[model samples]
Target chain A: MASKLGIIAGGGEFPGLVIAACRADGRPFHVLGLTGHADPKIIGDAPADWIRLGEAGTGFKLLKEAGVAEIVMIGPVRRPTLKELAPDWRTTKFFARVGLKALGDDGLLRAVAKEIESEGFTVVGIDSVLADCLAVAGPYGGLVPDDQAQSDILRAWEVAKGIGALDVGQAVVVQQGIVLGVEAVEGTDSLIRRCAELKREGPGGVLVKVRKPGQDRRLDLPTIGLATLREAAAAGLRGIVVQAGGALVLGREAIGAEADRLGLFVLGREDAC
Target chain B: MASKLGIIAGGGEFPGLVIAACRADGRPFHVLGLTGHADPKIIGDAPADWIRLGEAGTGFKLLKEAGVAEIVMIGPVRRPTLKELAPDWRTTKFFARVGLKALGDDGLLRAVAKEIESEGFTVVGIDSVLADCLAVAGPYGGLVPDDQAQSDILRAWEVAKGIGALDVGQAVVVQQGIVLGVEAVEGTDSLIRRCAELKREGPGGVLVKVRKPGQDRRLDLPTIGLATLREAAAAGLRGIVVQAGGALVLGREAIGAEADRLGLFVLGREDAC
Candidate 1:
């Protein structure tokens, strides 16, 4: 008997990518879409169910009934507001136990993961299932960053670490050592857009994204994709740097080709410090 | 001869406020407008000179010639780009000595301050001249921050510290635990405006402005004014917090009156950590 893999899908193309991977390998799966966030088309005709974002117990019961033992949660989900979600009694009870520690997003995710584990489903990082999607740890594309960009990348690397230490964000945009934008709850795409507006014509501009120090990688890893490359080029950025082996760069070949077309850089910086 | 106080003024109302203070007390002064940043009209009849931003030599020469030994640098100056300023021989030579550290605004300011001190000029904090302009510590409104707003403030305080630790910026806007805006090159008013758009109807939005830790007090101090109060009210925020004794709240009476009228809180949280 085949053990079915379960997928908890959110927004963005990640769920689509994961589904493609699952199907290519002939893995049977159950998809649970978080209502209002997940794309219906991505779930397709797969054995699937829909659950409101805060309906923990309902989601758990459905997955259990479907005979799923392991799951991968993927894609972007804006942190839902309690009022907006109107959490059911089960989620409310779960949060009550979480209490004040659930104030931070990381804490809330950890607590949620722990709850699901206690109920007997294992939470595995989606990356383990799709290691090929991990960002390449070197210069990507035809364009190599110039000396000025290297300097900017180092400065941004230091600044990003400071940002990550607080767990407020994962990315900082810099040009000639001036920070154009810092990501927060608004997310990275918005951060890149804001940087495009704030940027002055300059010699050195780079996007630096890093994993939060002490962050649990199994839950969330800093990620970039084709959209990030397009936006960086639009923002007149010279390069993009991610902590090597710590971020996902989906469709890496396409992203590299795009970067080359735009005369931009996609570098997975191991250590600029 | 009364020791003449020199004002190195930038944009915004802070310079105007300081000018009024000097005039009210009959304090002899010389004002130097950083070209393109300061409003020429703001100096109105005050003995003032205009110098290109980053023309440090010209600025120092003028102040020395005017027999000014003490100076206060005030208001917001868009950190000048090298090509835009076309630095004079002195600033060019200075940057050469400072090397790559000249890359950041804080490093540049610190370097400039050291140079000024080396030339025998004492840089004084503007608050020393007008204590009333310093933000009042504690409550100042018709409405107090409820529990949720308080939680947001603490979260924002932590985030702002991280931003400041990198010498990036000094303000952050938050709602619940979500950071709506982080101030960087765009400045505070722009940050507030951005937040107004990002805000969803909520119980917890607040502005937390703080002095960067280990930042030089003689230079930029975190500031807010009646404009901030009106904008925050427009954004549907519940409260505001600035580190006690560390921020400027221009026209205190008017700010308090406006906050009361808008039913918003202007709290000066000393240390809620």
Candidate 2:
């Protein structure tokens, strides 16, 4: 009998990838994909269950009923907006227990994970099954970082790490030892746009993204892809530095090609400095 | 003979207040206020020379030739867009020599100040002249922060100070120990508004603004006013914590009244934190 795996899909192609990787490993997988966040294509290709983002109680019940003893959470959920995701009685009770007045993305997610784990299922890191997707060290494509761009990358990397240490966020935009922006809950894409606005007439700066120190790799992994490359080019960014083996390279080949075309250096550095 | 002081005014009522304080002290004061940023009302009330923001080179020459040995940079200058500031030959030469790819607000101001000081004038802290305008420690109005809000304030304060240490602005918007945003060149009002967007439908969080660690208060002292109070209320913020003696309070009576009405806690903690 094959081992059955439970996957909590958020948004994006990550869910589909996780399913494919599990099947390739000959493991039977059950998925709980989020509505409006998970790719519809994932539903057709992967054998899985589904739930809306706010239906946490239903998700828990379904996972438990399926005899899911271990689970993995993956993909990006649409961020909880003020109108959407009014907590159900179970969730409200759970929140009451945590007692935080203003819960942010991390806080909310951690709370939900705790509630799910309380039901007896062990939550596992998504990377444990998809480790092959981790980015390698050094430049990804034909483009190489010049010494000047490399210096900016190192400086940005240091600042990004500091931000992570503070548990603020994992990314920072820097040029000439000055921070253009730091990623908070707003995420990297918006940060890139803001950096573009600040450096409107220049070649832009280096964007360094890394996993927070001691971050749970199962969730909150830094991710970059072709869309990221396109956005960086749009923002006039000269390059990007992501932590090697610490981030997911979604659409790695396409992103590399795009970076090469845009003359943007997309390098993965192993040292999480 | 009284010491004749030169005031380089920016925008806001700060210049007007400084002028009034100088007159009350019977000090000889002159102003070189920026056009498009400085209030025209300031020109009538303040006895000072006025000039456009980008015409700093000429302004410095005039102040130096007037035998002004000490200068105070005051008021809020509308941050100049790169296109708006048409740099003259001297400004271009200075930028070329500095080899800085991006000049943020602080960097630009520091460079201009360096040029002025090289010509023999000392840049004085605005606080040195208007000590009475400094905020006092403890709650100002009827609204004392609850324990939860106080914890949030302490958390936001530490993060704000860290941001200051980086010389990347001096304000942070935080909620439940999570930083919603860090002020860069965007300034505090916008920073508060951005945090509002991320708020999870609660009383909102605290806005913490402080003098940058080791900052030369001669330029860019943190400031709040009636407008700041209105912005905070609009952004759903519960309170504001500013570094006492390290920040300027404008429209104090009106601001206190509004804070009282809005149930917003406005406190100026001592700079020791």
Candidate 3:
């Protein structure tokens, strides 16, 4: 029998989808829901334990005690300050060991995964479990981007790459040759919502998301889902583009349907930065 | 006698400050206020004529008829779509002649200045008109940045330069090694205000503004005024840092006094990116 899967769930519908995937495949799994992040409804009936971010000791112990053999950390978690983190003894020791090496999002995540591996647990990525969720190349939902949107997409791609190389952000919004906004720690949803208020009167902006340069593919690849689609539509955005095979597309069918209904294009481009 | 100055005013108090400088120095001037931007109070009772942004032909004619010789363009103007700009015949011809070369802010500004220069007018920098407004090196208001704040300032400087080189923006906000936000077409005030909402729970961020790489210094040098100070204070930012001698600091004495009163450090750093 395959080893039981351990899911370290964070915010958004992503965690719930992963749990549903496990059930559908008859794969036994356990969840470690991060407090203040994972939805209560999603963790409701699952065999799970809840812990604060600083409670790394409790988290790892719970997973081991629950007979979890393989682990996958999923979803978005707001970056907390050192004070807010309030790291426990084990967590403090972990940071002390890593030192400044764990600075950017990818660095910190890789360090944590290494620690988990050192604790005798195997680590996996969400893509391995839900291969269909990886965005494919081409227009999604049978809608193609217009020439104007294509131009904006290309501009935003260059910007996203620039910021990503600096480890500043992974997404940008551009409209009619003007950059509407750039994502930072505020995340993509907030980025889109704010850019909506700053949109120009002409064609709406396009949101382009790509993976950060030198990023660890296993952790925190760019993601778009139903919630992101709704935000973009409400923000009067013309379209959404994610790096093909470099980002995740959650609830793909539903997202495509919503995009078509809203007269917006959802594309996964391979020619991306 | 000095040539009558042609003040092409946009939004913000910078324009009003220029008019005041001209008045104090006994230099005759005519103001051509862009309708939607210039404050009504500032343009009131001055030798001024108001016109929409697209009326370039009318604006130039008014300046020429006013016996103006030198021109200075000051203040922030939101980037408008071509439709919103509603370019007149001359403006259309100007864009056509410049073509793709006038895409970025600096590029567009240079093209416009060249056009004005060709029309028997000399273009001058705001520093030429208001020399004291240039930011100087050193800690302003007697407040010094703590080590942590200094680190964030340095980080934001690099990000600012990264975006600037791309001709994307000139300002960025950073806290605890995380980039809070980056300015784009929405401008710095909005960038600071929005980042305030996304500020981390611990130390507030620092706003860093620098000259864009290869920017035309005579046009749109990064600027901070009393309005910017209040916005930063309201946003709970620890300090504001601009490239020393590379940016404009309007109302310098008042800004120092306000920064002192608010217990925020306003420094002009020479070791900038």
Candidate 4:
């Protein structure tokens, strides 16, 4: 018998995809739907245990009852404010143990993954389950980048890396030779939207993404998908680039199809930025 | 006799303020307004000579004819594209001589200043004549930044300096401990506008601007004015901070008035960022 898998679902289609992948593989799984964050339709029909954020004690019990042997944390989870934490016994204890390291973004996540592991549930990266989701090197679309677009991508990559070293952001938009936008609190889609309004008249810009230098890939891996392609196309961008194998390309085939249809380029950079 | 002053008008109200200042002093002045830029009303009302950008030959001739001994370049000039340059023999020769060094923003401006000086007109810093236009140390609106806003400004100051080292931008917005937005090709007003949309629930963010580490002070000194106060207030920002005497404060009285009326703080940082 396949051991039941436990899923912690957040926003976006990622959780939904996880369910389908588990079902196709004949693996039974129970999802802990984070209230107000996970998609309503996806959590509504699934065998999900509704859990509020900051209720980790309750969440652990649900996973135990479901007899889950492994866990996957997937999708976009908006970081809550201090007041929003409203920690009960579990999350309060969780924070106490993490202590000062919780101040840094990566530090807190690392502690969370460590705390979950201490609870005896193996925390696995989503990519391990959905192997094909990792984007490959080279352009996904039939189209190739023009010289100017390629140059912009390279320029953006350099700037993005510098910002990453600061650990502030992962995406930047560059056109011709100048940077138009750098994503900080704003995510990639919004950054692309802002870039659209700022692009010069002659040609569109390039959206480039790379992992924050030395970032743990297991958590918060950079992702681009069909929606990314759609948004970039709508933004009148020439192309998109992400570090190959270091980022997730959700729905790769569909994204490639969309890219080709839109005459946009989706390039996967081969090495660390 | 008062030395004849030549005003090279760029794009913003700074040029207009200079003209008014000169008029008030009964200082004879001639304005060489860049054709596509500069406020039409202000330039039109003055003894102005119109010359397109890159037509430096005509500009030098006009200054000589006006008997101007020193010149002050003011206002916000959008950097022109290659095609827009359509370089007349003067600018074409200027770039050729500046050569590879003209690639960086500061380098190009420095070369331009040097080129103009070589033509025998002493290039004067705008601050030299408009000393009253410089923002002083301390708050203009009689309000101190609260603890949160103060911390955000300090945090933003650090990040802005890092970006400055890359010669990318000079301003950054920070709320809480996170950077909300960064300025690149997009100017301060737009960055503030973007920050307005990205700021989370809480007190608003702080805008921190400083001269880039090695930037030529005379060429593109950071600036703020009444419109800045209005827009920042409209965007729900708590305050703004800049390097004391290192940045131009156009229409200081009007900015102070608007800042006080809107309950926003305008600060001048004492230390180098």
Candidate 5:
């Protein structure tokens, strides 16, 4: 029998997807939902504990008492300030140990994962939990990218990688050889929405997402869902390109259908650097 | 006496500043203002020829007829589409010659400068004509950066240079070691304004601007003026940092006074990479 799982849920649909997957597999689990981040509706009727983001001690105690042996942290959480975070004793200790403020988002995640492991929980990656959710090589739907989009894909790939190497961002928008924007702390969705207004009067732009160089696979990998496709289409983007096997695609079928309906191509390339 | 200068004016106060400099020095010059870009008010009563941006052949002809022996291109023009440009026969020939669409903004500017030189006119950098406009090392006003602001400046400098190497952008906003935004096609002012919404709860961000690696100095170098200072202040940024001797600082005294009044530092760093 699969060990009881602990889900450390942040904002977005990924946590709900994981919960459904567990239910289908008959794997027992408990959720520790982050307040102000995770959707309370998603946790309805589930075995769960709710706590503020800075309440590390409470979260760990709740998971342990619930008899969880395995843990999976999922979804997006904007970086909060120290004032906003209001770290408790355990979180303060964790920050002291990790030098939290000096690290980027990925760095922070790696540290959190390490601390979770140190507490006797076997931390697992989302890819390992939901292997089917990983993006595959080539178009997700029936649409294929044309030469202009391919060129943009290649251009954005290099730029995204360049920024990623600096631990800056994982996504970029390019149109007709011009970079419309690069993702930073505001996240990919905001980046897309911002780039929409800056779009040139030519062929629409392409959104490219990739894993940061040397980034921990278990934490904060580039993720896109149906919402991403809809936003891209609404933002006048022609297509989406993500690194195959390096990013996540939640609700693939729905996303594929949505992409087709919006006339936006969703391609997964294996050539991301 | 200075050679009769040919000013290829785009949009912004840089053209006006250049024109003011010319009048102050009693230098004979003619302005070739781009129709959709330059301010008609700035070009008022000046020996100027108003033409569309795509009328390169006519521009050259007018300059030659006005006895222009030296040329300077200044100001920021949003990248326009070929359709929006409505390229005349000369621009079409120039694009065919230079592979225009394949180049970034700086690359296109270099090609234009080279073409102007080939047309028998000397292309001068803004630095050469307006030497006083060049940014000097250290603070521009009474305010000095705090340690945290200093750290943010260093972080944004590396990022700005990293993006610059990709020919992507010249500016980035960093707050508490997190990058808020990076400038792309939307320009520095837009980048600052966008980052304002993304500003974290702690100390404000710092705007770092640098010259692109291997970039031709004769073309677009990073430039900041009174408006830049106002926008950065309004965006809740702690300060602005520019590459010492590598960027233009227009209206220095007014900017310095404004910086002091707004409680923002405008530092020029000498060690930008």
Candidate 6:
């Protein structure tokens, strides 16, 4: 009998990738794909079950019925517009009992994770299954960051880490040692685009994205891919720095090739700050 | 003899309004109007001298020539785009030596003020000449915020202050205890517009603008006007809260009338935080 695993899929290609990895490793898995964010094609390709983004109650029931003991959560869930995702009676009652104060990304995710575990299923980080996908240090692709770019990266690294430590956001855009923009709700791509528009009068800047210090890795891990690189190029960004061993690199080879083609530097550095 | 004041004008009606207030009080003033940002019509009407934004070094020379001993900076100078204003050798040297440490608006303006004062002129806050323009605590318009909106304002007040303390920015948009957005370099109007877009998926929010705790009141006092209220309406915001006794209110009558017409609440609170 095959060893069974449960996958809690959010948005993006991460869930499908994980499913493929598991299949190649001969590990049987059932997926709980979110309705709006998850790709419908994933259901056909991966061994899985599916549910809507806010169908947490039903998701729990299906997982229990599958007799799943261990579960791995993966993919990006479209951050619910909190008002639209009014919790069902069960979730509302749970929240009422807990009376949480903060509702930041981490706080909400941790609460949701706890609720999942409270239902008697183990919540595992995706890294447990795809450790190989974690980004490595040093330059990626043919274009290595120059000395000046490296200095900017270091400066931005410290600033970004300070922001993260404050529990704000994990990404900042810098050029010539001046911050062009900081990420809040708009996400990285939008921030990068705004930086580009703001810097239209000067040379484009660098994007530094890292996992927040003490960030719970089970949910909302720092992620980048070919699309990210493409957006950065479109936004006239010179390069990007991702925290080594702290981010997931999707389509690594393609991202590398694109960065080289665009004369963009992609570097992964250890969390120095 | 009337008290002689020097006004450093940026864009908008701020400089004109300041001049009107001074004139009404029988205070004689000369204005150094920023070319790109200040309306030429207002400059012609105001009792002052004029200069281009890029002519900062020469602007000081003109100010000295005007026999200006006490100077008041007012209005919004278009933040110079990197390409548009190449700081002359003196300005370049100043920036190079200053380096990349974060300087909040007050710090930057104060440093600039000191640079001017070092050349033998006192840079004064607008309050020195037009104290009556400062906003007071109370409803300035017909629509008063209800208890629910007031609670949201209070919640946003804390968040906005925290953000301001970080020296990131001065405004935040919140609704029902959820922060929809925080301003950082993007400025308030754009921030509100973004929040409005997000509100399509969530509860319409309230905007909170406040002075940073320990902020140098001599410079960077938060200000709002008719355009701000119009922007808030465009962004679907229901109300606005500004720091009482710390905020400058320009076009008060027009702004008040517009806010009343739109049924938008405009409240000013003491900057206790």
DockQ for each of the predicted structures, in order?
0.62, 0.30, 0.65, 0.45, 0.73, 0.36
Residue-wise lDDT of candidate 6 within A231-271, one digit each (tens)?
89888888999988888888677778888998899988887
Give the winner by DockQ.
5
Candidate 3 regions exceeding 4 Å error are A100-105, B100-105
Compare the candidates by lDDT and give the number of the best one: 5
Displacement of the residue A25 alpha carbon in candidate 5, Å? 0.8
- Fnat for each predicted structure, in order: 0.59, 0.21, 0.76, 0.43, 0.83, 0.23
Q: Chain B, TM-score, each prediction?
A: 0.95, 0.87, 0.96, 0.95, 0.97, 0.87
Candidate 1 CAPRI classification by DockQ? medium
Inter-residue clash pairs, candidate 6: A11-A76, A31-A48, B11-B37, B31-B48
* Model 4 stretches astray by more than 4 angstroms: A1-3, A93-106, B96-106, B251-254
lDDT of residue B246 for candidate 5: 83
TM-score of 5: 0.97
lDDT of each: 0.82, 0.77, 0.87, 0.82, 0.88, 0.75
lDDT of 2 by residue, B1-273 (tens): 557888888878788888888889898878887878788786685656767665767887778766777888888664554456677666666777764443543666677778778878888887788876677788877888888688888877877787677666788887756678888766788788878877765556899899888766677789998888889989989998888878887756676788999889999898664
- Cα interface RMSD of each candidate: 2.0, 4.3, 2.2, 2.7, 1.8, 3.9
Counting clashing residue pairs in each candidate, in order, gives 0, 4, 0, 0, 0, 4
Quality of candidate 2's docking, in CAPRI categories?
A: acceptable
Model 1 root mean square deviation, Cα atoms: 1.8
- Share of real contacts kept by model 5? 0.83
* TM-score to true structure, per model: 0.96, 0.84, 0.96, 0.91, 0.97, 0.90
lDDT by residue (tens digit), candidate 1, B1-273: 446889999988888888888888888889999989999888778889999976888988999988898888998888766678687888888889997457566877777778888999898888888878777678866667887887888889998987888888999998877788889998888888888877765564899999888888777889888888888888888878998778888877788788899888998878544
Across B1-273, the per-residue lDDT of candidate 3 in tens digits comes to 788999999888888889888899999999999988888797778899988888889988999999999999998777767777898988888888987435534578888889999999999999999989888998779898999898899899999999998889999999888888999888899999988998988778899999988877778899998889899999999999999878999877898999999889999999533
Q: Model 1 segments beyond 4 Å from truth?
A: A100-103, A271-273
Tens digit per residue, CA lDDT, model 5, B21-74: 899999999999998899988778888998887888898899999999999999
Residues A68-125, candidate 1, lDDT per residue (tens digit)? 8888888877776667667888888898888743654567777877888899998888
